[model samples]
Target: MKAFLPPTSYEYVTVHKVQGDDVREASDVLAAEEPLEIRVGYGPVGQREHRTISITMRTPGHDFELVAGFLLTEGIIRSRADLQGVLYCPDVQKEEERENVVRAELSPAAALDLPRLERHFYTSSSCGVCGKTSIEAVHAAGCPRLPPGGVRVPASVIHQLPERQRAAQELFEQTGGLHAAALFSPTGELRLLREDVGRHNALDKAIGAALFQDLLPLHEAVLLVSGRASFELVQKAAVAGIPVMAAVGAPSSLAVSAARNFGLTLCGFVRQQRFNIYCHEWRIS
Candidate 1:
């Protein structure tokens, strides 16, 4: 399916442009950025409890997918069955507030460790997890190391992804200010794409789309991002069971380290018909 392009993804604004003393007023399109509040309802059937979990800045669209992806990657919920329902907050009075807020109801059978989640947010907000601790936390969250040699992608297929990813980024082409995450087949066909102001949010949207379609543990797929690969992105990929990840930009030191530890094949600077494989090179033939 083609990527869903939300009308709210961009806004038109009047701007002044100056080029070497030549100045003119023109209309410009900018990628829209807004805060999204994610809430969750859990517990027994009638005695459910709700809590506001996160408020993140994102381009408004694909809100449900973003929430679903966040829950799974964070180890809050395991599979699609864990999500009972997802909807906008109906109790909010303001229409805009209602649009900004989303609540995901979890299945009663889905276990929630509130204390651990609380600690996670505290550490994430306070100073961020250290590199070593972050790797350990992935294991603690039950993300297994990827097995080797299940999927092999040709180098030519890898070379074609950046261009395809760019072509599929409709909002970025219009606004020149959004990050994109895409899933591709091993043979290089685009399966899904999502764009957002935040890189992580974009990836979450893509992964969430896969999750909603019951396509998790994306073992035979390749992931491509429009920006540099970070430790967090690598961790998300591993958690999603994606075996290969490629980035148009560079991969950070910790990202490479985590990919090696997780046995994920990571490729960076994936443009100009060339790329660097950080670890598990056997997956890229």
Candidate 2:
């Protein structure tokens, strides 16, 4: 069955077209970005409560997954078992507002430490804090260093992932304005792909899907990003236990450092049948 499309993922916008020296007014397809409020609800059924965890500007599809992935990577919720259920706020009076709010109800036994969450809880679509304090917080999260000898990929397989990811990007084909993150198995099978205007959101959606499918600790997989790798991307991948990350663009110095410190295989400039491995070269044969 053909699934229904969420209207918030894309929209038609009037834009000025420019070609060489000529310009014309036309309607263009654009990837949508909107704010989503993520809340955490916990406590016994009779005494449940909610707290707004974050408000992020994101491309709105797979929003539930986005919330889940964000919570997991942020160290707010550790595992699938910590989550009771996720839902759009049903009591919201406005339909638009309803879609913009997501509540993740944690298990009754779960304990949330507000102090821990307060350190680096806020982030925007374009930038994630890489301050010394934020880095310390990431260290406090206790994401284990990626173990050695988990997954290895052939150079041929690694080289082909970008093209495969590009082929699966249906939205980008139409809008030409979205970033993507893809998951590939050790054998180079494209497991999943997600798109968003923000690279981090796309990555979150992809990780959230894997988590929903009980695919955490994806040590046998490689993550491919359509854009440059930043510290936030590497950090998120580390949280998901993803051992390898490849990008069609460059890797920031911090990204390279994070990948190296966490023992993840990092690849960049993955084009023209060539790529640079910034760290953990043993993962690629």
Top-lDDT candidate index: 1
Model 1, CA-based lDDT: 0.90
Cα-based lDDT for every prediction? 0.90, 0.86
Per-prediction tally of clashes: 0, 0
Q: Which ten-residue region of model 2 has the weakest summed lDDT?
A: 119-128
Off by over 4 Å in 1: 122-128
Alpha-carbon runs more than 4 Å astray in model 2: 1-4, 16-25, 93-95, 122-136
Q: Candidate 2 overall Cα lDDT vs. reference?
A: 0.86
Per-model TM-score, in order, reads 0.96, 0.91
